[model samples]
Target: MLKRRLANTDLEISPLGLGTVKLGRNKGIKYPTHFELPSDKEAAQLIGLAKELGINLIDTAPAYGDSETRLGTLLTGQRQDWVICSKVGEEFDNQTGQSSYKFTPEHIQFSVERSLKRLNTDYIDMLLVHSDGNDVEIIKRFGLLQVLNDLKAQGKIRATGMSTKTIEGGLLALQQSDCAMVTYNLTHADEEPVLDFAAQHNKGILLKKALASGHICTHAGEDPVQASFNYIFAHPGVTSAIIGTINPEHLRSNVAAAEKAILQQ
Candidate 1:
């Protein structure tokens, strides 16, 4: 695996990181039946396979129902080697079948503590503020950046970042916070100025939704996986791309894309 330095942090993460949104539930997809959650045993085996295959970064969020818990259970004794990036400010309600965002400082603290407990780790490698739309409101309501600074000082979280769905939100986060930024690749590519701004500021950039919600790889000979992965990897500012898959074969295929990128680079 190719390793890249996350901006202003000591952590060196793999170019390909695992996103756990699918591991929990098919959030945006409609299905006749609820998506089956992976068993703990299977999750553990996959985590082991990931480690063995040189994948060092695993990104999860509290909003990803049971994902953090499952990862925690799987990674109980092997926490030191992995860069476990988790998000706060949002959670999933199983009964309501919806996600709710919270931004109070109290709620932020509560969320982090719960994450720590669920992750079975004392400190997070990278803690991201998961935002829905109101970046300023969310930042002000919780003073989240300040809280993250305090947590860093207290050694509860090594670094902080923001995961946003908008270019405006990405730029605002970069201007206001010293932490890193995560955003969708397709939207970001369309807003090159924001990406350039982040690069100029030395802000770490992580690309999510790299596969365009599976639109990239839905047809024969299209190979959206490789195309999307390479597109993001070729972007100078992007440090890593998060790709999610439950199938081991598909996972290997994604890993092959990363390997190929490294060789070409």
Candidate 2:
């Protein structure tokens, strides 16, 4: 339940955010184990549990199937109590069963508008580009940063960021936007520089895949979840770790581990 004020924004986010990927999309994921999508009632209960645990940040995306719409229905009257983060670059196609990436300024605006309507909210707390690799090229050729800046200026989103796949893109995202989402866990330390940059520059850093996409292969007697949270929150730049889990007991354990990690810190 520890909070950090995200840089370049007025939002105060919890150290562990509730990632809503499993609430919607299930196919074509890289998670270690196949998952059954949670029911609407289950998801609503999960959302309530997350909020009860004092998690203020909810991460969803257009690429996450109907996550935004589910949250819109589930979150109903709790809009003012949470900071919602959605994405622009990639969209999930239910028919083709695949995700497509588009970042033309036209598409960017269109995505923002659609997200606003889907989320049943007037403004997004933050918007990130869901990258499909080629991150540097995407930023250089697509005018994504400018378009997101424009959206922010227009008050459609409060902040802009990129869920980057590489170090170069992470660095570029931090330089050009309010935050960057990067993968950082015990097995992967390559993205630490992005976190270091975020710390040095006072930019926000949202850690993705911190538990290594649920393929957390740990030695006997080692608690991967606790260890992952400990390693992540040890870094000052980590604004939050976006963990997607629908089970209430798993959520409770994660929260307890996160609290312990913060207390130890």
In Å, residue 169's CA in model 2 sits off its true spot by 0.8
Clashes of each: 1, 0
Model 1 lDDT tens row, 1-265: 9688887789898988887776776654443334567777777777777777778999899888788888887787789989999988887886677988888888889999999999999999989899987876677666787887788889999878788766676776776554445555543466455567777887777777777655566646756677666667766777777876666777888899878866665
* Deviating ranges (above 4 Å) for candidate 1: 27-34, 176-181, 186-188
Against the unseen true structure, what C-alpha lDDT does each candidate score?
0.76, 0.91
Model 2: per-residue lDDT, tens digit, 134-172? 889999999798889988898999999999999999999
Error (Å) of candidate 1 at residue 117 is 0.8
TM-score for each of the candidates: 0.91, 0.97
Give me the runs in candidate 2 sitting further than 4 Å from their true place.
217-219
Model 2 weakest lDDT span, ten residues long: 213-222
